[model samples]
Target: MATAAVFLDRDGVINKDKGYVSQIDDFEFIDGSIEAMQLLKAHGYLLVVITNQSGIARGYYTEEEFMTLTEWMDWSLADRGVDLDGIYYCPHHPGKGIGDYKQDCLCRKPNTGMLDSAGKELDIDFANSYLVGDKLSDIQAGQKLQLKANYLVSTGKVLCEKGAEAADGVFTDLLSVAKAIVNG
Candidate 1:
């Protein structure tokens, strides 16, 4: 049977959005994020990370560096008793990407490519899943796939009024969202 999932945005939503966070030293989990994942996991929600890493296209970092940091993040989360089911990222930037990275790809948010890929690969039940992101694009992406709900959290970059209005719900952070999901 397909599994319900909680799709997460990496930067801003999970970790502090320190611009171009490609190094372990720069990765800092937002307060309560780890706990949020643990709570979701305990409730049987598969955790999947969906992010836009345009910095790779901009040459700020390489894919290898990103992978290394991701490994560290996975390990850290595992140590804390949370295991992410999958992670998908878009390294393309239509205008600013360097060389091969400069393409308008389907994997970027608002396009639903990454989410679609996750659905197929992970056997995700889109109608039963939820998405939590800090940006409007993230909510848009989830909306396109008709997920159970899309939430915008305030712990990352400053959220604009429009972004707040676009989400199915808005919360102070991931933990709040998790609580809402688990309790309901």
Candidate 2:
């Protein structure tokens, strides 16, 4: 039996999606995000982050700057007693990207590269894992990987629309997702 995990999409799901957020001041953690992570952690689920950061590929920011901001974010979450197990990001875009980043990458969302890597490296049971994200691509990624559930959050770019049928479940915010995960 492999360990289970909760894969999270960083921008929009954990933090407010403020377009290529590269600074500590610009990184705003969404309400209840920390608590939700805490809940997952308490339940013995490894907390992992799989995100697409095309901003780096677009030259909006550097990888070093993204790491700086990520360090601050990790500190913030640690202060709240929620330690993330790992974070994986793909800085690639098929278009509008520079040089090495111009190619399509498997680690990007809608692909299971990150999840597969995390599963292999961290011993995660893909069939027992769950994913929470704000985009249809996120759901597709989890579905393709056969995760236990996928919760599409209506907090940022992927707002909930009537008759927009895609995800296994939908929530208004990360807090709502947490409630469903914990209560069920």
Candidate 3:
């Protein structure tokens, strides 16, 4: 059977969006973010992270560094009994990328490449799934996939009025979104 997932954006939704967060020392989970994942897990929603890591393409960090940080994050969440189903990132930037990192890849946000990959690899049912992100591009990606709902969380960057209006729902934080999903 296909799984129902709650696709998440990494920087804003899971951790504080410190620009180019490449080191473990700089990574900080937003308040209640871990608990929110736990709640979603308890409710049988597969927690998958889909993010655009343009910092890598821009030479701010290496893909190895990103993977190391991701490993640490997975372990940290495992300690809390919240196992992430998957993590998909786009390390390409059509502009300002160094070397081979500069290309218009399909995995970037505002595009559904990452989501499409997740759906196939994880057998995700898009119509039964949902997305929670901090930017307009995140919502747009989910919308393109025809997910059941797309939510905007305000923990990272501030959304413009137009961006907020585009979301199926808007909330203060990831925990709030989890509550709404679990209860409603």
Q: Which stretches of candidate 1 lie above 4 Å from their native place?
A: none
- Expressed as tens digits, the lDDT of each residue in 75-172 for candidate 1 is 99999999999999999999999999999999988899999999999999999999999989999999999999999999987998888898999999
| Residue-level error in angstroms, candidate 3, position 114 | 0.9
Error of 1 at 141 (Å): 0.2
TM for candidate 2 is 0.95
How far out, in Å, is residue 114 in model 2?
Answer: 1.0
Off by over 4 Å in 2: 160-164
Give one clash count per candidate, in the order shown.
0, 0, 0
Task: Give candidates' CA RMSD values in order.
Answer: 0.7, 1.5, 0.6
lDDT of 3 by residue, 1-184 (tens): 9989999999999999999998999999999999999999999999999999999999999999999999999999999999999999999999988889999989999999989998999999999899999999999999998899999999998887877999999999999999999997
Name the runs in model 3 displaced over 4 angstroms: none
Query: At residue 51, what lDDT does model 1 achieve?
Result: 93
Which of the predicted structures, 2 or 3, would earn the higher TM-score when compared with the native? 3
